[model samples]
Target: MRGPLVVLLCCMVALGACRREAPQTGPVDPSGDGQVTISGDDLVIADLNWTPPPVRIEEGAEGDARARAAEALGDDDLHATPASAIPLYLALSAISGEERAAAAGLRRARIRLLALGTMALDEADTGDSIAGLRAAHEFAAVARFLAADDPDVLTYLQRVDESDRLWELNRAAERALDAGELGEDGGGALAGFRQAAALRPGQPRAMQGLAAVESALIRRAEVAGSEGDFQTAARWLAHAAEVRPGMQTVVDARQRIQRMRATRIQRLRDEGVAALPKINGVAQARQRLAEILTIAEPGDPVARDLRQRIDRAVHYGDFRPGQVFTDALEGGARGPQMVVLPHGGFMMGALPGDADAEDNERPRHAVRFERGFAMGVREITVGEFRRFVETTGYQSRAVRRGFSMAYDERTGNFLRRSNVDWRSDYAGAPAADTLPVLHVSARDAQAYADWLSAQSGRRYRLPSEAEFEYAFRNGTSERYPWGEGTPPQGSGNMTGALDRSPSGRRWGNAFAGYGDGHWGPAPVGSFRPNPWGVHDLEGNVSEWMGDCWHATYRRAPADGSAWINPGCRDQVIRGGSWASSPAQTRASWRALAQVDTTNARIGFRVVRDL
Candidate 1:
């Protein structure tokens, strides 16, 4: 019995195993009458992440679903879409979350929805965005942010399947918010206000901001004024007046300006002209007059008064017309015997008791000469002198071969052994016609005077000491030609007073201070001409007067004429030369050189009765 039972169980087990392993059959289709049978791989389950896993769509199912998804995505604002689609998109993403086959469908819906939401935001003109143009910008920005990590997401976002009607929803919302008709949180909306202000400066809102700052300044100024800080307030008000638009502000500022001016004028009056600062009252008054004229009526008395005051001030203390003379001769050439003197005068000698008075001026006297006499206008110009030399064939003493006395710096004294001729001394000099023939002794001066007298058929000789002094002192008793004081720079070329030295080693003696530091003669009239139109009077070259140097005034005559020593041979040099100091250039100053001594800086001027 056990064996039989075991065999039965084994048979049952075999039948169960056969049932599990064998293919199953089902009822056949009635129309076809074909039996239904399971195939080897029938009922295959796909590896999916969701329940009720994805089924392959019948032929056109995918295309239909894609079209629907695209249509949904066409909304400008997916966020404004029917809330029902949200769950559908969420569900699709979850269902195809892990299956590559379902991913395309899920991704298409997501991208379309995202694109719509971005379009909605853009249409809102997030920051005062221009209606049509800026909306696209906002849309693009949002779209970019959403698809940042997806390479192909942008392609789907650009699709515009529907009329983008969702954009109208956003636009309506933006307009409502702008008009204050909506209760939307304005923090996001405020961005547009700021952007608009930035794009268009000085708009209502920008102007308001500027006005706030300006008003604050105005208030501060008013507070300062109320606190008795008028000056500070005035400054602030002045600035406000510049930028303030109202005529009232400008008028107030002008009043303040006028008040300040009046106060200044009162202060000046109290201080007196000398004590007051050297402000130009006339100029200030004129400026005020100009300002008044701008607001004054044409025939107003105040305007008339201001005009008269300006005219009077302009003419106040002005110098009267004076005379300045020039040579009447054409080309300003020195005529054969004619002379022209620019008008001026000088002191004839030292004061009676002046400490350093020289013996010759013991009886100090005042002398004056008014008439500007005709004298040789310039040291005979080279052209004129050359004609004389050419016509007369007169050989100048300077051309005669002989050594003359010249200062030697090495020896600190005069040296007499050098052979310096005029031609060699003045190398490359212009023709002698224009050059005052230099290297001529006093004898030469007299000889030239004699020759000129004969040529012009008129008396022309060296001026006497008195005549020369009178000629030099044109009409005044001042120390120098210009005035009683030392001459100013440019008054004449002379050795500077400051450069004078007592060592006698300096170029020219301290006595030779007039010609600006030149030891030898400069071209005639190179220095500033004397007021009397004389050149080289206070420097350049000493003149050869017709008088001898007198040790005392014991026998001097009082007449304005030369007083010559009965037995004196050497001629007097009345006016100091470039080789003398300021003190020696005085009208009465005197020196002596041998009558026959000839060298540069010893030229002479002649005197002729007008």
Candidate 2:
């Protein structure tokens, strides 16, 4: 067998050497193993004489008959051409008296025909293929019938059909490469190579085409990257992946781009952050953000961080919107915890569906904040108010008067009580540090705000009526801060019908099915806050606003500024208190009090301009 194959191979090589080669302008396959075609012919194919099977008309089991038939067929070497097996199968099929003998002959003939046809096409010479296929088909049709519907035979035929298509696809890709159409508009190489590879795994020509295209893509990406067109470079590498996914060069290239983006993003962030403290820092920072956005991936941490910084630039100092922080006082002491409200706009009066809207609350017009401001996280707590009084040696208007309104838990009524000042609780008892301060007149509240401004070097003042309502609304246009329907349990210290006073007395009208566990003011921060993260904007107590008393919003300032009538005796108040009725808890509810009128139900929160 070795002697015949060696002699045949030597003859074919000699024949191939004598033939003239055509000059190809197209790029040759980089892999020498690609486009393999066996250079041989039928004369070069070797075969051996076989001893024919003995006549066996055994009327026995089908397996026994097939076993005898296979014994006669002997060892069928797949590597050798099936030429000699054809004569033996023909003679056996001719002598068949049983179906088993005829079937066995047909199976052997099918195998020989399939092998001959496949081997013929393996050579580059069309003459050899035509002659070889013609002999195999003529032998099968005239000498014996083949089982054409057999799975193995059908699969081999289908593969033969697909090879023609794959050959064309791979050739087109190589031609595209030679034409310098490696995806630069005269395109098709990448798509062609990728399609051929996917359609036929391990096809040598397709694999070679893909490898060549991938190399070209890598070179193109390198050129673009060297020119500092990183985005364009990345685009090339992405195409390389489509041609041959997970190519190490492409993987490494993408990682390099990510690192470059990270480094650039970091540098931009540093520059933008540095510029934030300068006079025109925000303007400078915005420019950096635009560039980073182009290169940075979506939801990049550095990009998100830069954006947050820019947003916070419009807030007080370094504080972000909805963030709570405390400003430092003169002696390194921190002031009230202030929550930054984002600069935005909102309707400043009663909501549309609110049937209880008052005349003064009509004309719900838009009030916009041109800039952001920070408000005390809660109404000035008793301890915080005490700090102001102690620092300035201030005598509150109520203290000067030596009397203020105080609640009587027994009668559930408010009455004037002597010695009831900022230091007093609702019942004029000694207040806890955590409790919200009350019984301080509007003038007294102003003094504390003025003192805070002087101490912290920030503009601390009472919020205007509009600002107060807007802040508490926290981006909602609903009538209640907690939304429509019954308030959730522990929403705030607002009045509830189920709540009992120290005397076991319940309110005639309050939020039904809701109890905040308090009949009077609870300690500040005891209740759940509004959505803005500010505590006790409602329910703890009604609050004093900077605006003077007005009958309506007819001539109101649309900019959210206080509508002040200098020397006005009356001041406006907003929000609901623990003892407030259900109707009083409506978001737009407001009332007036004499500037000198200090009350157990009213307190004030400060806002600092950003």
Candidate 3:
């Protein structure tokens, strides 16, 4: 080290002319010796021994030297170089007065040497020993040239020692392997890992290297088995087996691989079947149906029928297709329908304090619809209604009368109004074609129903209040079609205050505060559909029922059918309109309007026999 230090000092003095001005005072004295000494212009080489020589730069060679240094630093793959190359370059640069070049060379050389040394220790390969020794000598020489105060030089010296220690560990691992203390797979992997660990033992990656080697060997064996090289595969497997004895999982895996090679398809099929749970009867049928549906072509009759059967079963609480009921109703918007109601009976009526609950909804009578029926899934869309009107020249009550009831906030009531028609109101709106016809009166709904019946040659009409309720209730006798709770906002575009209002006289002001105080009707079904798949059952508009609005339930029919009153002029509207409040939307809630009365908030979904 002292010999290298003297050499470095000589080089620094020789390269003094090309050396840049030192950024700080003479070398820092960590020993606090209070001695001021100078070896060359702005260069103080101190404390020789283990230290290496400084990188030197001769006059006029500064530019070329810096360029060479940059080039060396840029070689990312220099790790393949022998570590000795790094220190050798540093010593040469010092002698040649090319300090910058020497620094770059040394940096690359050190990194590569460290990597090599670490790898050598891990693999226990003596191939890197010569290079490692050379790199150590070179580093020591450069350390001597660096100012005694330069922490960088001291750090490099410490790194050299650490590299040596790793090398020693690698040597010990090699010795162990040679002594038969470790098997080929395990010993070889361990030797490599131990070397990496010695260099950076605290890093988890050091252990990962060992694992990676094991994985590679395993994969090679698997590949051999896949290629029909059974013997080679067995040999690889045997190596692994020797390394990890008593590992039943590995043994089983090897056996399985052999079996797969013997009977690939059968083995796969057996495994697949074994993985499936034992299913029976209805479950098996359901599973088959699901599989068929997944791969079935769209519009396939069989698939469609199967899907409908499934829906019917789910609705009626019966897995048997024949068990579900079906009746014919002239197709309204949706073609040919069936009525399917839940089997259970429900206590239909106003609870303790239902605001809009009338005497008719009292006694909370137990009423039941024996079967679930599939009614028209959707209300007649504008396009369908338009076709009916065009084909029959049937003028809707709203259009014929040229006016409809709209809630007027200023008047605190619904008033006769005209500016908007269904076509105009929903013009340019997306999905308008599928939206239920709005701004139609009870008369219009009836006419459309009549027209549909006539065209289809089947009976079609507004559902009786009971039928409507049954359909709306779906199966659950909850407050709403969905369940027994207030629906979230936007479930339907009804007046917010109406939905928020409690049932009673206090709630009567809903019409006045319609639109949540904004006052206007929103498009039909601009909210969540009921569980039964019916939309706008409540909120968007009050739907006209076939029955007349009665003052009480004195003689109301228990059957799920309409109780029509021939003498009545005012048609009954169930399911409160957008202008009405939540109380008005209750199952027992009712409203009355002249048969010819048309309103923006009044629209209806038709019912058919099925």
**Each prediction's TM-score against the native?**
0.39, 0.60, 0.41
Deviation (Å) of 34 in candidate 2: 27
Clash counts per candidate, in order, are: 33, 0, 46
Q: Tens digit of lDDT per residue, candidate 2, span 1-610?
A: 4332223332222333432322111233444111223222222121212233234333444445445445444433211222234334443455435455656565774575455445533421222232332233332232223445677666655555454555556556666775657763435776776677687766555566666777777667766655546688788877777776766857876777667667778898999999998999998998898878977778989989988898788554576677778889998889898888888899888877788888888787888887788888888988999998888899988888899899887677899899998888999999998889998889889998998899989889998988888888888878887788789887888888788888898888888788888867889989777778887766889999999999888879988899999999999999899888777888788899998888889999999887
RMSD of each: 28.6, 14.2, 23.2
Error of 2 at 446 (Å): 1.8
- Which residue pairs come into collision in candidate 2? none
What lDDT would each prediction earn against the true structure? 0.47, 0.71, 0.53
Model 3 alpha-carbon drift over 4 Å, by segment: 1-340, 353-356, 407-413, 418-435, 481-486, 497-525
The alpha-carbon deviation from the true structure for residue 436 of candidate 3, after best TM-score superposition, in angstroms, is 3.6
Over 4 Å off, model 2: 1-228, 232-258, 297-301, 315-317, 342-344, 370-372, 408-412, 484-486, 499-508, 512-519, 555-561, 565-567
Tens-digit lDDT string for candidate 3 (1-610): 2333222222222333332232211322333221222222221122235423244556675565555544544442221222224433654565555566567676665555344334423322232232333334343444444333456556655665555555445444433433433334455535655565666654333333333333444555677766656567777667656533566635775876666455432333333333333443335445545554443335645545545454544444332312223233344334423334444566656666665566766666666665454455445567767877777888776666666555454445556666545553322122365556667777778888887777766567887777777766666656655444555555665555443422221244443333432233354445566665566676656788898877766667776667787777987788866566667776667777888776556667777553
What's the lDDT for residue 321 in model 3?
Answer: 18
Q: Largest TM-score belongs to which candidate? A: 2
Report the lDDT of model 1 for residue 45. Answer: 21
Arrange candidates, best lDDT first: 2, 3, 1
Candidate that scores best on lDDT:
2
